[model samples]
Target: MVQPLDSRQRNRYSRQLMIDSIADSDQRSLLSSRVLVAGAGGLGSSVIQYLAAAGVGTVGIVDDGRVKRSNLQRQVVHTVDDIGEPKVESAARFIDALNPDVTVETHATRITPDTVASLLRRYDVVVDGLDNFATRFLVNDAARLAAVPFVHGAVYELEGQLTVFRPGGPCYRCLLPAAPDEETVPSDEPMGIFPSVPGTIGTLQATEVLKCLLDLGEPLDDELLRYDAADATVVRTPLEPNPDCPLCGSDEIDDMDDIDYDDRYRIED
Candidate 1:
C-alpha cells in the first residue's frame, strides 16, 4: 500500500508536488521506487544527482573504480577529498548529502556476466551509464532476457545517444545486432569529452527512468534520441527492430550463460 506523505516530505518536495502531472501521489510513488545506475562516471554523476534529488527510495550504484584527480573534469559527484575512495562509496555520500531519505546500496565491483542479471533484477529500472561497448551489450542482452527496462545513454566527445528498451519491446540489440570487430570498436574512454555532453545525456536518461516509473508518457522503445553538443542540436529518429536481431530475432538469444562478452559475443551456428 502507498503511504501518505508526511509534512517533511511535503516540504522537501514542494516544487515537484505543485506540478500538476507529478502531484502528491506521484511523489509517493517516486519515494517508493528503486533504480540501479550501472556506472559512476561522467554520465552517472548527473543520473545519480537527479534521481536522488527526485527522492527515489532505493538506489543501487555499482562501480569497481576509485575516484581520481583526472575524473573530476566530468564526474561532478566526487571531489578531490574523495580521490582515493571507491566510486560507489563517493556516490553514496553524494546521494546521502542530497537526500537522506534515500537508501543507497553500494557495490564496489565490476559488472561481470556472473553478477549482472542478479544486480539488475533488484531494481525497477536500470540506467546505462557504462563507457564501453562490451558491457553495454551485456546489459542490453541481460535486460532483454530478464524482462526489465534498460535506459541506455552514451557520450563520446560532443556526440551522444539515448534510447529505452522495455520488456517485450525492441532492445539495444535490435538497433545494433553485433559489436564491431575487436579492432574496429572505439576505445573504452572516448578521445575527448565535452563535459556537458554527459550531463545532457545522463539527465535525459534520468527523465526516461521517471517516465517509466510514472507511466506518464510514451517510451522511446521504438526510437533513438541523438544529441550533438557542438551545434546544440538533437535528432529523434525512428528505430525499427531488425527482423534478424540476435537477441529478439528469428534466431533468438534467450540465454546469456555462456556468451563471452569480453570477446565481444558470438551466436553459435
Candidate 2:
C-alpha cells in the first residue's frame, strides 16, 4: 500500500490541491499513482518531469537511445554532460534529484511487442511519447492488453497532437487504421522539430495523466487536441472507436503471438 504524504509533502502539494477541481482526495490519488512513460526524448522529457514534480508515486521510463548534443535543444532533462549516457538512465537521475518522493524505474531498451505487455502490466497509466506510428500502434495494443488508460502525444515540425485512450474510448489503431510506411516518415534529426512543439504536446499529455489519476475534470479520452504552434491555435476533434480496427475493435486480441513490431518506423529498422 502507498503511504500518505507527510506534512511537508501535503504543504508542497497544497497549491494543486487548492484548485476547486482537485482537492485533498485527488492529491492523495496522485500520490499513490504509478505511471509508465515510454520514450525519454523531446516529449518524454517534459512528460516525465511534470509527472514527477506533480508527486506521482512511481514513474517508469523506457528508452534505449543515448543523449546526443543535438537533443539538448528540446530534451530538457539531460544536460551537456549527460550526452552519451542512456536516456532512461539520465532521465531517472534527473527525476531522482527533482523529487525523491517519486520512485523512478528505468528500462534501458526499446519497447517491443514481446516486452510491452509485461512492462505495462505494472503501471496504472501509460504515456505514449514515441515519435513513430508503428510503436504508437504497438503501444495502443499493449495498453489494451494491460487494460490501462494511456495518454498519447506526437509532434512534427510545428504541429502537435494529444489524446487519451481509455478502456472504451478510441484506440490509436482507430485513429490510424494502419501504420505509415517507414519510407514515408522522417526522423526528428532530419525533420527538425521546433523546440516548443513537443513541449506543448508533452505538457498536455502530463495534464491528462494527472486528471485521469485524480479522477478530476473530464479527461481527453475520445478527443484529439491539436496544436498548431506556428499559428498559435489549438483545436479539438472528437475521436470515435473504429469498429473495424483489428487490434482494439469489437474483436479482442486472442494471443500474444499476434503481436509484431517489424513494421515499426525506426532510423535503422
Top candidate by lDDT: 1
TM-score of 2: 0.93
lDDT of each prediction vs. the true structure? 0.86, 0.84
Task: Indicate which candidate wins on TM-score.
Answer: 1
Clashes of 1: 0
Per-candidate TM equals 0.94, 0.93
For candidate 2, list the clashing residue pairs, or say none: none
Worst 10 residues of 1 by lDDT: 260-269
Q: What's the CA error at residue 59 for candidate 2, in Å?
A: 0.4
